[model samples]
Target: MKLTLQILTLTSILLPLSYPIEFNYPSVFNFGDSNSDTGELIAGMGDHLDPPYGMIYFKTPSGRFCDGRLLVDLLMDAMDLPFLNAYLDSLGLPNFRKGCNFAAAASKILPATASDLSPFSFGIQVSQFLRFKVRALDLLAKGRKYEKYLPLQDYFEKGLYMFDIGQNDLAGAFYSKTLDQVLASIPKILEEFETGLKRLYDQGARNFWVHNTGPLGCLAQNVAKFGTDPLKLDELGCVSAHNQAARFFNLQLHALCKKLQSSFAGSNVTYVDIFSIKSNLIANYSRYGFEQPITACCGVGGPPLNYDSRIACGQTKVLDGSSVTATACNDSTEYVNWDGIHYTEAANQYVSSQILTGKYSDPPFADKMPFLLPIKF
Candidate 1:
């Protein structure tokens, strides 16, 4: 009995809350790196040097790696929703059910980077969420209502969960390093991600929107630091190597999702092509009032986003033989790289708009897609 319970506990920690749908409003559950961080890092762990980071806008440091809101927060705002608190934070059991975001800065889908942060893994975050559900159940079972929160059983068939990670696992692993060592580990990493997805589906999650990766090589921090031709492109606005990898990942993700949808029979799964949309944004920043996509608004003096990957969530800069700030751009909205690795709030908004409006597919965005993904539904 003890051993069985332990195994279940370990599995619980490694899996996510795949709940059955039961509500109208989407519970904005997020999982990724700094791009969607929100105030979680401000809750601790990030070190953006304060003031100047969010100075131009927010007026106070919000854990975002920019002057204002992150993509997740902005999406919530666009949807007319509240900023999701972490599942483990101050808002007790009663308030958690509405929606909870479990993303942590520097967190990745790969387990190898797990050791870096107390060896934390992406699976652990999901497990923690399951435990939260258990807590809610316990609270209910004890005849103690947690502010009368609604249960999945009560809501039934209308909920949503957006999964955004994979980028950290790929980019972080090969930022300073090359994709040389990543080849062997890539499959395993992807397998782990697949496991997490299956776990979520098993838990009753009906509608899911899974976003794939973007062009990591083109991020301004990389081109500025590594010196890639910024404006040079083969009509697609993507460098040869970066787009190749991104395309491959997208293809695989698409296939995996297709298999899952067919295999699951009645599941409503949506695979969002964030890669193509992001590539379009970078390739056509000029269309959106930006002039550059190959440099970050804030980063240390060199490529791949400065700072040796040791520090995140702070002001970064570069100086040539003298002390001068190197991490910032004249205006963040004009550039695609926000602090080197993530996109700016504007970029995020644009992409979300693409996802919502209709600019993400082959031509008309969704016309080329095989399945009819209902964005409004």
Candidate 2:
């Protein structure tokens, strides 16, 4: 059967029931870039990302870059919480009960080095969360009791704080600088990340899930832009040099997590190995029912993979004096990539399943003090 968003949502809801009693976090607070953004970019900036972008599931542009739910959405659904609302949504903060997403499309980890595509940085997202906490506490102090909302005392300490950043940092660096230059910047980038984590730790956040950078070499965008030579490409058609950069970053991040675990007493700081999980998926695409592993499901104006960096998905423009509109594949499920940069809904489902399994997580999710049980989707 085709894996649609509805099916994925249903799977998320039902999967947790069979697991043993586990750490049921009161809420989830996420910070990252487009990968975890629900609608913050569209809500805050009013970017015109029109039709076909969200046609697969939402049937309308929901500010998500992909065709359906992101890993964060599925993660929340697995915990039986409503998908988080973008903190900047015009509808207002109706539900802090489940938590709010501070993620924005194109956001970077460092404000100083952010590209034009990413105006908001990780620091900005965390600042917004801090402001939200103040308001939530103020409202509670005013004796305004809202249903499903937790008291300020339990809310600050018990929430799950998630970070899925650093992709844009590397992307920006690699595109503008050399591989050696990007490698040199990894330590400073990780230091900025550690600063953000420390800020949250000081603010009473005890449960932390930090997702490492994925295998950027396998992305259709990187392959199209950097994998021109056969020797530079891997067996899976991914850029070998780019994947090496990703590995270096992940290794540094894992070591940082170890340091964080020691620094934050009684806190659960876990490093999620998204790079390994995604790399394995691309290497073994057939096992995951994916026919096209490296090519984008939606793109235009190119050879080999048909991806055009100038033309975005769901867009039409004059290329070489001829109008070209980016088009999607007949079956999105058959392709792992959505639009050269993002993953398809089906691929995200598989990745999310692995994340919840406690397999890729450092210190293992189930082994944590709160005892998170594995989800069986």
Candidate 3:
């Protein structure tokens, strides 16, 4: 009898603890621009996205700038969540159980980028999220049929809030203003970001994942636009000046993240270093199975790289009186860049892997408290 009891205890101890685990938040609320946008811009505005954009994966335009999925899509996949639907996508209204994407292509963190056509700035996106929360709360209070979809209480407080913005803001400042002016605007930009975070905190958001800007200089579009002299180019054929600016922005952002962590006692804020990951990819493309790191997979003109500033991806234009269409490469998986600005699905996949590896994220997500599960193992 003693031997049998010992055997049973050993069996129980040796058994693997495998069961379903719920995330801290039932849903993940994402906010950003083109980098994370699923289809918010397309739904809000018209269909600027055309063929060749999603040819590699979806076989049709899914309103993404890349040839396939964005980093956010890959992240969702890692989380075992469904692809987030754009909040503006009327057709996807029924699928908000997981969460909604509030990102808009070409939108900036600053209000200056807002126009009549593309008015969905970062601020506006946050406002929309606020409105969503309010409506969900109202439905729950009324004892409506939303309990199956929306969390009745503490949803916002529990949900993961991610931000992948600041690219457009820096781009706009760099192009429209002088270098010094652009540098000067960093504080203001960060200030707005801080304000947004505070607003979310006020509304019960505690978990935040913020991705810093990537190496802007290495983008084929930026290289084509700014890399005029060989001396200005890095070894990887990227504009060094633009990259410096990006680094500067990232440094300030890191400091800001630290400040936020201290200010918000209970909040879990993580700063993701996307710049380093992307830079490493550019430096060692072969390691990541990328044949072309500097050139775009879909573009029209090039001596250094095939990227036309005026003619965007999936568009035909008469350049030098010769009709040329921005075409996709035979294999997008071999290339790092899809268009001039966005990354290929493969590149995004690699980057997303790195992001989730807990190497680049501050305080590593795995080390954080796991989401509570009702069913205890």
Residues 294-371, candidate 1: write the lDDT tens digits. Answer: 656665645434423333435333434554443455566666667667776667656765665435532232332221
lDDT of 2 at 230: 89
Task: State every prediction's TM-score relative to the real structure.
Answer: 0.75, 0.92, 0.89
For candidate 1, what is the TM-score?
0.75
Summarize candidate 3's per-residue lDDT along 266-363 as a digit string, tens digits. 99899999999999989998865678888998987853588898798889999888988988888888788988899988888678756755679887
Model 1 residue 331 CA deviation in Å: 2.8
The digit string of per-residue lDDT tens for model 2 on 192-271 reads 88888888899899988899989888888888888888899988888887888888998999999999999998898888
lDDT score, candidate 3, position 52: 94
Better of 1 and 3 by lDDT: 3
Candidate 1 has its poorest 10 consecutive residues by lDDT at 368-377
* Comparison by lDDT, 1 against 2, better one: 2
